[model samples]
Target: MDVDIEDILAELNTDSTAVDQSGNPFSDINNNNNASTLYNESSSYPETNLKTNATSTSIPSPQQDYNNLIILWRNERCAPELLPYPHNLMTRMLSRIQEQMERLEIISMDFLGQQHSTTTTDTTGNNPVNNNNMLPLLCMEAELERIKFVIRSFIRCRLSKIDKFSLYLRQINEENESISPLQDFLSKDEMIYYESHSEILLKLFNDTILKHLPPNMQAINDNTGTVPMIDEPDWNKFVFIKVIGPQNKIFNTDPILIKGDNGKWYYEVIIPELQERVELIIDSIYVMRYKVIKDLLMEGKVTLI
Candidate 1:
């Protein structure tokens, strides 16, 4: 669990490449090429059919979808309560896409109207005909296409993350108070949306996989804690552990018995929530009473935060 700082830095620098410490590709929202690559990778899973309902004949162009996602992501931060529910997010985005398409139609009508008025003026000899009138209209059409493509790429970047890290967010939602600091990202309404979605997925996973388990293993483990269960690997990853009380002049260090090196593995971890770092001690370190950092990042699956 001791992560190599150099390895972490290297991954951060070359995030566009598909190979990380685990050989899986990392998410990069600025990359466009990753859309097709991620789609092809995720397509092998029948459970990952993420497209909107196909009953509606009007399909949104990728650009329009991307634009709506960006707008939604931004709005979620400012007005989390008003953010659309998970089931409705895509529907709302599709509506925005249709609006963009409608603008194209209006633009076409305006062009025709201008052309008709120009023809009348030319017939009266007020002005000579100019082919350049179409230039600005043509330019506007071209610009809209370019905008759509850019928006599509941006959306694909987020979609790729959702496709890959969904397992973490599967059980995360409003009612699950066990996960710490979720309030850092989600609002009350958004939490309800995700909680319901997580329940559905959790039930599906349990139903499909539980039947195959041995009779003794059929019952699920409901207890989740920071303390390791029997035979569970002890976490040695660097963490920000705060002292339970105020720091005084007298200090004593506990003997290092865990995995980290006595001297080399110690780090001054900053706790922004506490606004300070505490003195180091192997045993006195304050791990969360309920949730541990390892479970938050690794197992409990609250990835977005």
Candidate 2:
């Protein structure tokens, strides 16, 4: 029997045929369209998965490979080579470097020692007697003597060297006490006394020797009325003096009046109202020479006697 197209269409339109066993005939058509699209995509892009796997397993680039090769070559070149027992080239190189460093340290230490020796010789006049280095020794001795003369003339006191050094140490100790833990050992009054004495000495030093003594002369004689022989007046006994004028002016060659039989010097004028008697001493003469009297003496305004 021949099938009719109209009947087949009618059967497809029926509810039982249109609906699936689970009541969804359209679901089957949608699934088939999706499968067709997926098949077409897979065919068109055949190497997609292969391309992904290849990218994941890729090796380093040419530049990176070159850099790695260079590093490997360096490692091989620097690698320690095996040597005979008890003799390693790498160890020998390290030992040589260490020896050179030691030698440099020794040279530096010797140079420092020489410098210190030179400085000490310059200051103390005790030249090192390395007969091999005679020129440096002579130079050092000459320089030291020059420095000693300058110090003696400018800074040495009429007091003994020991006394002067003691005073200096005391002054230094007092100054250090401000920052030192040894402050507890010094009494407050002692510190104050040192400071006051130091100030007075500084003023006197500035006014006298520093101001008056000729640059070339180590000793200055300040006796008036006829130059006395060295035996007549003891040079060592002379004390430093400074003569102050009104308004901070100072007098040079300040007249020193020798008292009768006492061999003492006093100021010419005694102000009973102030109960102050000015005195003239070596220091006074020195200061006066620089501050006031030099000009007057040069002008013949005043005579020393």
Candidate 3:
């Protein structure tokens, strides 16, 4: 197509040096002469090329989209505020990445195939321009790789949270007890780890406490609190006892039971008027001496405070 000098001059607001009285930008040049002579004559005249303009107009850049994705992924990864439910967000993000990858694949295949076909048609395998076109393809490949890496990092970051807060996650999933905002997002391994770790710690604590007790003193069942007295026992002799109560039960004393924001219940006993809070509903946590809270711990009906 012939270059429209009039349209070009009008678009450029008719620069005084470029446009003459006849309205033609290059009035001095003959039609037979090359246009490069006019461009070389004046630095004020902006050079325009048909092929360069066409290529630039045809291909839309995806740089902005890539930038937006990077920012979103970074924020999602590093933000301290935890979403109440992250599974849904993960599902959405993964789906978006899959769709984007599929689209990118299609675009890359079509573009690369066209370039390859064009290059192959020329028997001379040494086309410099064809080789230069590979730069854009290389840049696209690099961008795709970057996006993929960030996405993988983002997923790993989320899984790291699941690993770090495994106990809280298990508590939420199993007992509907959300100890943290990220509690509901748990994996099977995390749940198993929490249960096993908790059981081990409780067993160790129980055994350590039991080892300090006298031989005559033993763990008495809730139904049988009366232990057989040892021979020649002094009046000061006493046994160490431990017990736990079921959930949602009232204690003998008017213990103030309060549930925390994390869904764990605490008790404040009025007898000794405890200044500190005591956790409730733990099966192995109610440790007491038989001499003090013996009768209360034996009765399964009353919850420890």
lDDT (C-alpha, whole model) for all candidates: 0.36, 0.32, 0.39
Screening candidate 1 with a backbone cut-off below 3 angstroms (N, C-alpha, C), the clashing residue pairs are none
Q: Model 2 segments beyond 4 Å from truth?
A: 1-132, 157-305
**Backbone clash count, each prediction separately:** 0, 7, 0
The deviation in Å at residue 254 for candidate 2 is: 29
**Of the pair 1 and 3, which is ahead by TM-score?**
3
lDDT string for model 1 (39-69, tens) is 2111122322224412122232233234334
**CA shift at 122, candidate 3, in angstroms?**
1.8
TM-score winner between candidates 2 and 3: 3
TM-score of 3: 0.33
Best by TM-score: 3
Question: What TM-score does each of the candidates earn?
Answer: 0.31, 0.15, 0.33
Q: Where is model 3 poorest over a 10-residue stretch in terms of lDDT? A: 20-29
RMSD of candidate 3 to true structure, Å: 28.2
Q: What are the per-residue Cα lDDT tens digits for candidate 2 across 105-203?
A: 554455457657777867854455433333433343443344334323322221222233334344444667665322232224434554576568667
